[model samples]
Target: MISQEQNEFLTQVGPGTPLGLLLRRYWFPVAAASDLNNTYTKKVRLLGEDLVLYRDKSGHLGLVQERCPHRGVSMVHGIPEQDGLRCQYHGWCFNSSGQCTEQPNEPEHSTFKDRIKIAAYKVQEMGGLIFGYMGPEPAPLLPRFDGFVVDNAIRVIGQAVLPVNWLQIMENSMDPVHTEWLHGHYHEYITTQNGSKQEVAFQRKHLKIEFDRFQYGIVKRRLLHGQTEDSDDWKVGHPVVFPYMLAVGSGGLGTYAFQMRVPIDDHHTWHVWYNAYVPGPDVEIPDNLKEVCVYEVPYKDQNGAFITDYIDGQDIMCWITQGAVADRTNEKLGTTDKGIILFRQMLKEQIAKVAKGEEPINVFRDPAANQFIELPLERKKHHFSEGFASITQRFQTKYCPVAQDLIALFERVGVH
Candidate 1:
């Protein structure tokens, strides 16, 4: 359990805070790659720092302090230059390294150019997203996913702006029981079968949870809440990477979703993600497959919304209702919250490590890692319909055979 002090520390994500320091240890997705095209400057907020994202004409991306050094004007009005971004207010140019290069208005003032520079962070592009590291210079190389670096697979990226704390959104990824209840039992927008509500339950024993640590090369066993005779106790183990990343799988769709919770502030977060799947060559990809969903959950509403609405709407309703701090003191967590407990414990441990200047888990870059897969077999029995069978058959026949060898290869390398 986190102490009151620790909880307070976790809530503050401003620069130098414990949670901010911990989160800065890993690279975070700040904007979509598509959004960075030929733009002079884009305003973004991450870890509570308001900053400007711009790409120089030389084709380099930068994350710099939002305010210009000269007049403290916001850099959002800057124009792209040959080698940097030039502030529209006075034509002060800054390079990708955040160094003020040209002060056209201050000719002969070499000292101004030499001494004036806005704060900047390391930025990189990977897997169709742009990532920024806001902590320190010489930051570690952005972590790579071996599974995603494949040659033949198509990639898709999407994002959502959720109205909740970053921790609440990140922790939600660790709770698997929500799938059974929120996605299954609840009469939400997504669960209605053509306007009809269906009561759904999970067969728990068959649910398997594994936490794959890329650095340690260990897949730990996770105890999940099993289905019982009297009540439905839903719990599943979820791997919580140190910092702010959570890797989770849905038991029904065999979909693995990676969520990066970027804090806009203490009360709002940018939920950026990449939802990818290995589609067979024979299958045509849908134009709208990479759709983005936004959810706005208020801070005072408890029985607010269901998970079935556009994913963003559902999350917003559920999380905002918990209020800004998510008063866990008044809440009761049981067996179904196992994943949540594990997540909180892991976070506390990582915070302690950060406090001591030690490296937390799963923050290193490893090129030899295996790909992760979310097995959908646990809920396969529940989906029994001609249409469902047809879809399954199409997926199996078109992709499974060709990918079996690739899947086996990943399995050999310890991906599950």
Candidate 2:
């Protein structure tokens, strides 16, 4: 456990905070591209700063402070003009660059517009998501991760605003052992898609966990029984993209899902789960799968209790039960928590780097170095047999929809 002071230093994200400043250096999705229209503006809160995101009539994107500079009016009720948003309270207007352009309440000849401005930042759209950079000047280019750049892929954005600290969700991603219980023996099987379900016990079996640092982030490897040292499971694992995002499945639909755990503040997180489905080389893409859908998911069931339907729901339960900014000061961690330990260490190191004014691991400067970044997925593709036991593999497969799709993808891709 860490001291209260140390905990605050790592998790608090108000302006000028250590962790918040570190996070600001990288670009994160502020909203779904398809959700933003000329009709309305989206309110975004990140790193404890409230901001507004909108698309103008001209189809340009704008991200600026949520409150107007003049009288601190909320832009949520503002009007989207041809180039910027105008305050509905008065005729005062601000451009997409957050520069005050018009002050109608003032004298017709007044020059007050030149003396005031609102905070604005660089915003860009890629892979069906709108991303914003809130760091220092000359912002780095948003790296085009391979999962977001698949050709002819059907992009899916899974958005959820969890009432918990972003750190809890992030730490959970690094922990591969949780699958043994939360998604394994402790979980009740629901249904199956493939042929006759195979039943096998997975309790008390010896498993090995490994962590390897990648160019972008960490790759977590879980080795189950019957897997050898040179096996793919023991080799490559899923990529935990720096900051917060996980690439899951995509072998079949020709897409992979990117799990984005974006911090809305110290206690709230904008959990945007991105899924991309790409059809095979010669296979015809289905018309139904072509439609784009972006929506928020709830964590409750019809019964009103915390939804325990599938693995994802179960995972959410873990996060919520931990409380917002979990009392890491009172928790007991075991050997299975090595990944979390490594994650915390890296967090500290990266925070220190940002403190020294040096860029962290995944922050890219050169545009050339920022595109088409792909990690080793050969393990996730070929090591499918190692993720669970045969007896409960179907339920495991059903729980991890991404991996299920990719398992078929691996077979088609002809990856040994």
Candidate 3:
């Protein structure tokens, strides 16, 4: 257990805080590219700061303070012009760099616009998502992970706003044994209660679990009841990519996905399930797949009860029940929680490194090395013997807009 001070040190993410400063060094997704299609502007909250994301007529992206400096009005209603965003209240225009450029009502000889500025950060778009960097100057390049840059692939984005801290959601990725209970036994019970005829496939007891500190973050391996050392699950397990993302899914001819846990603030988390379905070379990807499909995952019913039907929904139920910040001071951890303990230690070490004026893990710089960053994941999953139909019914993929079409795609490619 840790003290309250230690927990706060790791949890608090406001401006100038230790964790906040460290998080600012990396880029986080602020909005989906399609979110600004109709309105061309979005209000975003990250690390306890309110900001506005907009696209100008000249096809440039910008993230600036939500409030205008002239009259403190919201910039969400600002107009997107050829050069910058112009406030609707008074025609005050600010460029992408947060420099006020035009004040229509000001005197022709006035220099007030030159002296006015507001907070702004760099924004970039990749794979249908817009990411923002609020750190110091000389920002690092946005990482081009395999799922985002791969060719002949279909992608979809599913998001959920959880009323919990981002740290707990990340800690869930490290706990391997929870699958046996939370997603296995509890899953069986919930399905039975809901009057569903399907049986849970994750009932195997875990024999042993291990974690290793890799260059990216931590790679977790698990040995189940009937698995051996020769199994791919033990040889090349999946990884948690640095501070925020968990990379999961099967290898060769299967799906690859990333679970991005974006911190909205101290008490809220924007959880994104970014998935890519890459089939064999025998198949031809459809032309309509150029634009990614984005949807919101439902966690609660109309009656306000938690929805535990799918895998991600069940995980959300547990994370939200842990309270807003998860009181680690009164919690008890066991031997099976070795991975969680190791991850906490890693976080502290990285925090200390940043405190000493050094770069932490997963900050990319070299463009040559950043091209197509491939993560090593298990070629075979433990429950994959159940086949592709299992994935279509059990995961968030069930709600995908192209669910039936993808099933047909796998059939045509003979991947099942």
Candidate 4:
């Protein structure tokens, strides 16, 4: 168990905190591209800072402080101008760099606007998601992971804002043992209670689990019941990308995903499920597949109860029940908790590195090297043989807008 001080150091993500400083070194998704399709501006909170993310008339993206500098009016209702966001309250305009460019109510050619500025950060669009960097200047290039840049792939983005610390959600990614009990036995029990006749696929018992530190982040491998080390699950484990993402999915079936956890604050986390479905060589891609479909995955039902039927819902239930921020000091860890331990150690090491004013892992700078960085994954996942239909039912894909179209696409590609 860790000390209360250590837990606070790790869980706290407000600005100026050690862990927040470490987290700020990397980019995080503030809004999906589709979010701006309906409305140009979205009020977002990241690293405990209230912010407004907007798309100007010229199509440039900007993220600035949510409160207008002049009167503290929220920029969420700001007007999108050609070059910047104009506050609806006083006609004060700020550019993408947070520089006050215009104050229409002030004297013409006045230098008053020149000195006014608010917090603004650099934002970029990659794979239909808008990522913002909130750290120091000379920002690093966004690492183009394979799932985001793969050609001829259909993309879908699902998200949920959980009232739990980002660390718990990320720690869940490192814990392979949870899959056996949580998603396996617990899932079976839940389904049985719900009176569903569906078969639970993740019921397989794990024999062994291992963790390895890679250039980007941790690689977690698992040996399941009746499976040897030769299996792809053990041989080519998936990666948990440093700071934010867990890269997973079946490589053989051309289905890949990234579970990105963006810290909304010290008490809430924005969980993103980014899935890419690559059709077979001979399948004709549909025109609609060019755009990423975005949706919200519900973790709770209409009756104010946590929905634990699906895989993601179950995971969310556990994470949220751990309290707003888990009390790590009171926890008991075991041998099966090695992955969780390693992840904690990694976080501590990275936090120390940031404290020393050094760059942590996965901060890319070289453009050439950033182009299409591929992550290792198991070729044949447990659900590969079950086809795309069963796969959809197990995860958030069942809530996807184009779930039927996905099934049809896979069937045409002879995946079924």
TM-scores for every candidate against the unseen true structure: 0.74, 0.88, 0.97, 0.97
List model 4 lDDT by residue over 1-416, tens digit each.
88999899989999999999999999999989989998889999999999999999999999999999798999999999999899999999999999999989898979998899899999999888999999997898888999988887889999989899999999999998898888888987887888974556577888999999999999999888888889888998889999789998887778889999999999999999999989865567898776899999998899999988888999998898889999988999989999888988999999999888888988999998987898999888773547678877778878998988988888877775
- Residue 169, model 2: lDDT of 90
Among residues 3 or more apart in sequence or in different chains, the pairs in candidate 2 whose N, CA or C atoms overlap within 3 Å are 158-273, 199-391, 200-391, 250-255, 251-406, 251-409, 253-278, 254-278
The 10-residue segment of model 1 with minimum total lDDT is: 376-385
C-alpha root-mean-square deviation, candidate 3: 1.2
Task: Give per-residue CA lDDT, model 3, range 1-416, as digits (tens).
Answer: 88999999988888998999889989999998999888878999999999999999998999999999988999999999998899999999999999999999999989999999999999999988999999987999999999888776788898888899999999999999998887888888887887884556577899889999888899999888888988877888899998999998887557888999999999999999998888764467876665788988898999999888888889999899999999999989999999989988988888898899899999999999999999988878875656676776688778878777777888778777
Q: By lDDT, is 1 or 2 better?
A: 2
- Could you tell which candidate, 2 or 4, scores higher by lDDT? 4
| Superposed Cα deviation of residue 347, candidate 1 (Å) | 1.8
Tens-digit lDDT string for candidate 2 (1-416) = 98888888878877899998888988989988777744568889988999998877787889989998778889988888898889888867888778999988798898889888998988999988889999998788888888777676655565778889988898998887777666665553522233333232333243888898888889887777766767555676678888888766624224466788888888998887776655555554455445555755667868878765456677888999998888889988999899998999999999999999888998887878766877566524432344323211232233332444444543555532
Instruction: Tell me the lDDT of candidate 3.
Output: 0.88
Write out the backbone clash pairs for model 3. none
Count clashing residue pairs per candidate.
5, 8, 0, 0
Give the range where candidate 3 is weakest over 10 consecutive residues by summed lDDT: 281-290
Q: Considering TM-score, which of the candidate structures 1 and 2 is the better prediction for this target?
A: 2
Provide the lowest-lDDT 10-residue window in model 4. Answer: 380-389
Model 2 stretches with alpha carbons more than 4 Å out:
189-206, 250-253, 379-416
Candidate numbers sorted by lDDT from highest down: 4, 3, 2, 1
